[model samples]
Target: MTQQTTLHAAFAGHVAAALDALKAAGTLPAGLSRAAVAVEPPRDPAHGDLATNAAMVLAKPAGLNPRALAEALVTELAKIPSVTAAEIAGPGFINLRLNAAAWLDELRTIAALGNDYGRSTVGAGTTVNVEYVSANPTGPMHMGHCRGAVVGDALASLLEAAGHKVIREYYVNDAGAQVDVLARSVHVRYREALGENVGDIPEGLYPGEYLIPVGQDLAREFGDKYAAAPDSEWLALFRNRAVAAMLVMIKADLALLGIHHDLFSSEAELQAAGKPDEAEAWLRAHDLVYDGHLEAPKGKTPEDWEPVELPLFRSTKFGDDQDRPIKKSDGSWTYFGADLAYHFQKAQSADALVDIWGADHAGTVKRIKAAVAAMTGAEGKPTPFEVKLVQMVQLMKGGQPFKMSKRAGNFVTLADVVEMVGKDVVRFTMLTRKPDAQMDFDFDKVVEASKDNPVFYVQYAHARIRSTLRKAAGEGMAPSADHLELLGEEELGLIKLAAQFPRLIEAAAAAREPHRVAFYLYDLAAALHGYWNLGNDRPEKRFIVAQDINLTGARLYLATQIGQLIRNGLALLGVEAVEEM
Candidate 1:
C-alpha cells in the first residue's frame, strides 16, 4: 500500500526544508548532523501549536547566536503556505502555528485513508519475531501468564501497524522437570480414573484437579494398560500427552483474550534436533564457552552449595554478573543453554527478536542477552534482541484478593477472569499501565462505567460518535469536507489531538511500549468528549445544525474522523471498537 503522509510527517518536512534553506543561504553549515533536531507539540498549549529547537540545536555548530538563529528560522518558516504564525519562544525555540487549512487537510487525509489512517511505514522492510507467553506446558494458563500474553500480543500488533512484518511466537517448554512432574501427576489421575484410590496427591507431583480430565481420557483409551505399568513404560507417553493437553488448555485460555501465536516452538524439539549442541560447539570453538569452575554464589556455604566445573558461557565479558553454564553436570542442557539455542534459531530468521517475560525471569535476562550477543556475534552478524519484563498482576474483587480457580488447582485462571469481564476489557485493561509496574486487575473498577475506567471512557467516546453518526444518517445528513474552512479553532484543535495517532504509533513501536497507545487513545477520547460537550450549551457547536446544512456536514465529518482514529488505535491494542458502551 502506498503510504499516506500524516500532518506530523508533512510539518516535519517543512521544518527540514526550512533548515535546508538556511544552509543554502550560508546562514548555517551543510552536513552538520540534524538528527538531534525535533519538531513536536509544545509542552504548554499556550505557547503555540508546534515547537522546534532548530535554532538552539544548530546555532553553536553554525557559529551564530541563538536569538539570531531563531529569528532567521521563524522568518523562513512563516513563508510556508499553510503556516500562519511563526514566533520565537524563550531560549531560541521556534513555535509555528498553521492555518485552519493545514488541519483541514489532515482531516481530509484521515478520510482518504480510513482504516489505514494511523498505519506507519517506519518499520517497513523489517521483520520482528515476538515471543510471548512461553509458559510451561504443565498446567492451565493462569493469571500469572495473562499480562505477558496480552502485552506481547498487543506489541506484535502494534509493530505490524507500524509496518513491520511480525511473527507471533510461543515457546513451549515441554522438555523439563516440570513436564515430568506433570506426567507423573497425570499417571496418578489415570489410575484414579481406573477406580484406584490414589489417595491424597503424592508430594512432588502436580496436585491440580485440572489433570483429572487427561487421565480420564487416557483411562478410556488404554483401559488398564498404563495404570499398572512402570514409570519407564508410561512416563514419556504420559509426558507428551499431558503437555499436549495443557497446551490445548493454554491455547483456549489465550483465545478467550483474542490472542494467538504464529509459531509454537518446542523446547523438546530443539533438543531432539541437537540445536543446543550446535550452539555449544560454536560457542566453544569461539572461546566464548570453556570448561570453567563457577565461583560460589553469594551467601552460599559448603553445606548448602558447591562450585562445579562445567561448560560455561563467558557472559561476564558482556557485563553479566558471571559466566553461565550451558549444560549441567549430567550432560543435559541447562535452561540458559537451551534458551540460548532457541534465541539463536529465532535470530536466524528475523531482523530482530523480542520476548515478553514475567518479571520473575529478570535475573536470567542478562545471561541470555550475553549469550545471544556472543553466539550471534561469532557468526559476524549480531542480532538485535530485547526482553521486556512484565510484572505480576494482583487480582482483586470486592476490595479483597479474588478467589482462586478450582480448575487451575490454586491460582486464578485467565479464562475465569476473561469470562467475568470480557475479552475486550481483559485485553484493554492489561495495557492500561506500563508493563514493568505493579498492577491490580480489580474486578469492580474494570467493569465500572465511570470515566475513571479508561477502557469504558474510550469505548464510550466511540459509542457516542457512532450514535451521533447513526442519528445523522437517519436525518438524511452525511459527513463532507466541503465546508471545513468554516470549522472553528476549537474544532481544529480537536482534530489536532486526533491527528497525533500516526506519530504516536511510530514512537510507541520504536520504544516497544504498546501501553502508550492506550494512554494516547484515552487522551484523544477525552478531547473528543470534551468537544462534544461544547454543543450542549451552544446550539451552533452541535454536530447536526439542521438550519445550516454545510456546517453540519463539516462538523459531522470531523466527528467521523475522530471516531475512525479511535477505532484505529483500539485495533492496535487488540480491542474491539464498541458501538455501544
Candidate 2:
C-alpha cells in the first residue's frame, strides 16, 4: 500500500491545485474565483470516495455548461497521483476514487495523532464567551437546568478543540427579586434558629427546606444580632449572605455533573459598579432609549396595565414586537435592563458571546439581540450576541415521571440525578438530543448495558477495545503499520468512519451544536461493535491472530485508533471513557 497525507486536507489541496492548473492551462477563464469550490465525501459511498462541486459552482461563471466544465476538470484531476478514477456523475458532480492506500494512510494518521486527531484550526485566534447554566442563585440547581449546563460545557470544549479561545461563564442573577424571596425564606429559618416561632413559610417565598442550613449558619455567625431588626435594616445584609451561600450550593451541584465555570458575573456587582447607569446613559445619547408609553403586550393584558411613561428601549426599531421597559413602575431596573448591561460588558472583550437559556425565555431573545445591536451600532450586521434557547428535560425513572429529591422542592435537584446515575451517564444522556428538542432522561435506561442505551453502547465499545489491547500486550503484541494490508473492507470501513472526526468537529463547532459529537461517537461505536460481532462467527477476523504477530499487530493498531477517537469525543462531552464495564 502506498502512503498518503491527511485525507480531507490532501483532497482539498488537490482540488485547489487542479483549479489553478485549469487557470494556468488557459482551458478555464483566468481570475476564476475558487471560493465556491468544495470537496467532501459523497453521501453515498458507492459514488467513489470523494466528490467535488467545482464544476457546478463555477460553470456559469466560466461561460461553459456544467457538463462541459466537469469534463474539462476531470481531465486535469485524473492526473493527480491519488485519483485512480475520476468520473462525472449526476448534474456535473465529479466523483473521484482514491487507492486503497489512502484509506490505510488515514488510519495511520489517527494512530500518530492520538487524542489530537480531530483538533482543527478553523476558529484559531477567536475569543468566544459561552454563558450557560446561569440558574438563579436562589437555591440548588433543578432538573430544568441540566441540559443547558451539559450543552454549554460541551460546546465550550468543542470550541476549544476547534482552536477557539473559550471562556465558560455563569451570570449570577443576584440583584433580582428572586434573591429577595430567598433572603426572606432564609430569614424565616434564621428567626427559627434564634428560638422564635417563625411558623410555616409564607406564600410567594422560597418554600424549599434547603435554606435551613444557610439559616443555621447565619445564626451561628451572628448570634441573634438582627433577629428583631426591620427588613430595611437586614434585607441588604441578609440578601448578600444568602446569595453567597446559595452560590456555593449551586457550584457544588454543578460539580456533580463535572461542570465548572471560569467566571461568575453578578448582576448586583455590575449594577454596583455603575455599569447599568453607564449603559443607560449611552443608550439615551444614541437615541436607543427614551421616555415612552408602551402598548399592552399581546395575549396577556395585566389587570393593572396602564400607559405609564417609563424609560423604554426602542426594541421595535430592530424587530421586536414592542418597545421594552428598562425600569418598572416602582422605578427599579428591570431584569432585561441589567441583562443588557452585562452583555455589553461581555462584548467589550469577546469576539462572540453565546448565552444558553431555558426555552421559556424565547420571547426575550429578540429584544436582547436588538439591545446588543443598538449598543454596538451593529444594526443590520452580524453581531456576536447569540442566545441559544434550550428546551426543558423531563426526568424519569422506569416508565413514570421521576420527582424525588433530598431538598423536597418543586423540582428535582441536579445533584440528585447525578447521584443516581453517575456524572458520565447524566452528562451523556443529556446530550443525546439537540437543545431545541425536549428529552426524557430515564434513570433506569441510562444505566443499562444494552445496545439501546447510547452511553453504555459507546462506553462498552471503548472498554472492549482496551480489554483487547491489554490481552494483546500480555502476549507481547503491539500496534504496527507493517501488515495493515491484512485488513479487509470491513476494517477499512471502520477507518473511514474514524476519518470523519475532524470534519465533524469543524461542522459542529461552526454550528455551535456539540450534540453532534455525541451522535458521531455513537455511530463510531456501532461500527466497532458491528465489526467485533463479525469475529464471533469468523475467527479469522479476530484481532488477536495468534499465528501471525504482524497481522495481530495491525488489527490491534486499528482497534487502538478507534479507542482513541471514542476517548477524545467523550472527553469533549466531559464524560469519562471507561476501561472496563
In model 1, the worst 10-residue window by lDDT is: 1-10
True-vs-predicted CA distance for residue 118, candidate 1, Å: 0.8
Assess candidate 1 and give its lDDT: 0.90
Best model per lDDT: 1
TM-score of 2: 0.94
What pairs collide in candidate 2? Answer: none
Report lDDT per candidate: 0.90, 0.89
Clash number for each model: 0, 0
Q: Give lDDT tens digits, candidate 1, residues 342-409.
A: 99999999999999999999999999998888877865778989999999999898789877656767
What candidate 1 gets wrong by more than 4 Å, as runs, is 1-3, 19-37, 53-75, 88-93, 301-305, 379-381
